[model samples]
Target: MENKKEINRRKFIKVLGAGATVSTAALYGCAPGNHSSSTDNPALGEVPIDKMTYRVNPTTGDRVSILGYGCMRWPLQAAPDGKGEVIDQDAVNELVDYAIAHGVNYFDTSPVYVQGFSERATGIALKRHPRDKFFIATKMSNFQNYTRENSIEMYRQSFKDLQVDYLDYYLLHSVGGGSGIKTFHERYIDNGVLDFLLKEREAGRIRNLGWSFHGAVDVFDYLLALDVKWDFVQIQLNYVDWKHASGNNVNADYLYGELAKRDIPAVIMEPLLGGRLSRLNDHLVGRLKQRRPENSVASWAFRFAGSYPGVLTVLSGMTYMEHLQDNIRTYSPLQPLTDEEKDFLEETAQLMLKYPTIPCNDCKYCMPCPYGLDIPAILLHYNRCVNEGNVPKSRQDENYQRARRAFLVGYDRSVPRLRQASHCTGCNQCNPHCPQGIDIPKDLHRIDQFVEQLKQDTL
Candidate 1:
């Protein structure tokens, strides 16, 4: 039998080391032109900056990339592109090739991403390369189709789709996806699903056993306290949510601190707060630029998440090549933020709090709104308008015009019309579903009233 301890230790060493280098190289631009400290021979010293940072897992001392390639946002084709009728395979291949060549070894994906095409796309893209060149991580997405058979099928399909007999990291997806964890355990784990997974691990099918969480601290603690040793756990960690928990209306600081106490390696999701932190206000952006003018705004978010010690990897949904390259540079030779920089970000966080900005990370946790309202999408547009100080113009000119076009023009192509925030009856069904504890209906009313005023003014 293979030694579980040794397997985990080896994995940690590999992941942590690979990740550390990536982080360090990314700090300076790939081409050491402007940011190079010494002015020796410019031509001789022209070296491309590495695009990943590595962290050492204390348990096994494996080096992992600071920047993990997230497959959830892979480019998709309209139709007739690949097997699943989605996901541009050629683009995926290019991105994966670039990422791997640049030192990003960890590729994070799930069964549900891109309507289930992500895993297949990942497998197809990576199959040509040496298996050892990269590490693959996927999850047990037993939430939506919550059935024993369905769950089992999904788990089984992940390996097949990933084209890997063994997974470097396997996670119980979204442990905080409602009382779904209990359902998962009862349906799968308690009924020997965990046993099956563990058996596979014993057979070297799963290199690591952990979960990505999005719920209460109690739930997080429950999973962490399990007698079976977990190799790593993924969490939504970003500047905005640093002070907030996933769904429990609690601060994330407590949750992360608990993990730190237990010595669990934390894989971070949404380090950029679903790309919100990347595009910050002018004041904060200016401050960040002052600290590191060469680095992109997104680098600060990644650096802030990496500034903490317990973090194993910070994952980003890099859809474009430029985004991927920028991130790689950020993580390569990872530059941990100084205390002064951290303080500045904290101050910016407070300033952001002053604006009645909805704390939605747009994780789409409360997706498929019963009333046909694009809750997250609307919130995003609203936030953008507010941030840009064009709420009146946005509501009247943008959303209203779009709605009019949708209703008047081709309804099939456009987003289906239903209740705008103005039409919200305040049924308040979405309130509890939100992890951010936002007053959903109340805010909808406020926005709706403002939009109404705008319409009336033009009338």
Candidate 2:
């Protein structure tokens, strides 16, 4: 019988070997289900003087920068003609250039970001550089249009839009049961989507196949079991989410362990818990400051996720230069969080669960609200207002107005005016769909009333 050490050695060898012909089952180690600094991965590259740390994929021996550039929220400016259409080309190009110059190379985007323009914008910006300069990751998001034909066409269109023949990394978008995963396979896999993708892979159009998960651990495993040979999996992993009431994204410990067992790598998302961790409460901030006075609160969260062994990269949706710079500094030469610091963060995580705030991570899952509710966006604005100490009448009025405009304007433009929040009619269809269990009709009515009052005041 092979001993534990020999078994692990063999697994590591297979990990660096050519794809899929090996026993993926041998990839898991016998150590406790947690992270450990093992052998020095020779293929791993160090972040430049400008960067901090580097993470390696156990399977492919690829060294991805610890901080990945997430193009989901690119900076926007008004068009040259100032027609109110925001021009993002220059900002996107600069950000992409800065990231690459700093030795950061993993770029993640999706077809649905920025009203379906993020992919095009990212493709154009990155195309300015050599293809080998970065790994392009995007998703097949055809859930709302759930048909097999729609899914395949969307995948084909993604390649055309990104100006790349093959995706370095491709995900099945979100991994929930309802409209997310169910619709994904219905439109993709069950409809022979995997067969088509495999043919593309054989032709080298897809370098890696992966999925980003949301609800249902079983569904995540089920997707992995499908013989499709997933190269990696992305999960919403952060110190706060480990024990989040929504689901222990802390379950990520198990999820990552399982993936490692399967020789699959993990890409982490929501490291700042959709920016909440960046705007922590004063007491928690003080505690973190006392421990590491120089690091941003967001840095602690990002490090906590990167401290793990199997994570291939951490994604941050940086919307501004300062945000990008701060993240670059954090990952440039990261100091792993101490055990006491991890405990403190876990304590902070528990404290975080005390608030009445909704658990929307801005994953855009609750989007396309049938009632024209800009659900995640509105909730995020509200949460940001409250977190930033601008919730009082003296400070919150302007922010409140902005939120009102965003919701009312988005409702008018995206959702039909008649189907606006004012017309919710208390049907309760959206209540159960909300992962956060928030009373949808109740909040919509409150927002409608507030917007009406704001309009009256402006009048």
Candidate 3:
């Protein structure tokens, strides 16, 4: 009987039409200087930066940007004092000014983001403009100290850090993970933090209240089941997660449907799946490019996130000017995917599953492995090699020699020998820290074995 890997590889080959090849240039439209198409053909370089789509919040009637700014991954710079990395306030200011001017009116931040400096830097940028011009959304991220006093101080500190009297949207950070319902209760319910925030809402200090979910479906259902009005819920949503939610266990289809049923708006996070969708395999990129010749690979994911009527805003962490510009182009006059296009995307998702690449997004949360393994780099190199068709299957295959050489050479170059997966001792120290729920030691061991097999020309 064929094993799972064999079956998946067969499916992958079937999807790609046996040994068909797609050029990187064709997948990415064309080279920068090569514009040989007809005059009537639309230029791919023309991005509508000024045209942004807005979604009105049903509860507060705020016209939030469909492309909401996620301030978690702000641009960093060497601090003037030379202590360490710090948020680049000037870059933040420029990006914020450009986004707001381009019609992005909603900004999401948290107390825990950017080493707790995100709120202050974001405040510095947004405060320069009129307070009423943009909606500021932040979170009560007191995960360690769940006591009432600590939680309250954290909440008040957000107001001070953000330079806002009232919050437009507020969240219970990372509610449905780790200890699950027990952690949720201890962090919010038992400690009276949720009740306090509820009263704050009534007092008009918090305009909207919600929670961002991570683990345990029951905890998510329980929070939603509460009779209290939830203005919105922030969720990790994207094409891949809609059906196959990766490490989250729960699919976005169910989450979004439940929220829609309750009339609760959804604020989307990870719409690009931490940049995974944007950096797809050449074949997948070719498939999308064939359908929409002008749109970006990332734009398809953003449009999919925003197509749903229940979504209030789709948050993107724009760390660079180009990312911000590209995202703005995607949302400006958002085009909802048609039924046929949706079906096509579903097909693409299935084809992607056949490739069997590790779903690591290079989040680096599982870093500094106890054994000194560069966990993210190892996984990233493996995933990249797999995506680029450099994963050798057998010595008999036509591309086996080439694939093996590329994979081995690239792996060595990408990850230092000292920090390679071969060094992992399987202590399991990094497993719990991973948001994607990857079994770190086990995966590293598998990768190391694969590397050894490739070296022996037996894979």
CA displacement after TM-score superposition, residue 335 of candidate 3 (Å): 1.1
Cα deviation in Å at residue 428, candidate 1? 6.9
Tens digit per residue, CA lDDT, model 1, 99-201: 8888888899998665456899899999989998888999887654545677778888998999988899999877754564575476557656677777878
Across 127-161, the per-residue lDDT of candidate 3 in tens digits comes to: 99999999999998875567899899999999998
Q: Against the true structure, candidate 1 has what lDDT? A: 0.66
Locate the minimum summed-lDDT window of 10 residues in model 1. Answer: 36-45
Best by TM-score: 3
Q: After superposing candidate 2 on the true structure, give the runs of residues whose Cα lies further than 4 Å from its correct spot.
A: 1-50, 79-84, 179-184, 245-250, 368-372, 385-439, 442-459
TM-score of each: 0.78, 0.76, 0.84
lDDT of each: 0.66, 0.66, 0.78
- Cα lDDT for residue 42, model 2? 12
Between prediction 1 and prediction 3, which has the larger lDDT? 3
Which regions of candidate 1 fall more than 4 Å away from where they truly are? 1-51, 58-61, 80-85, 180-190, 244-250, 369-372, 392-446
Which number leads on lDDT? 3
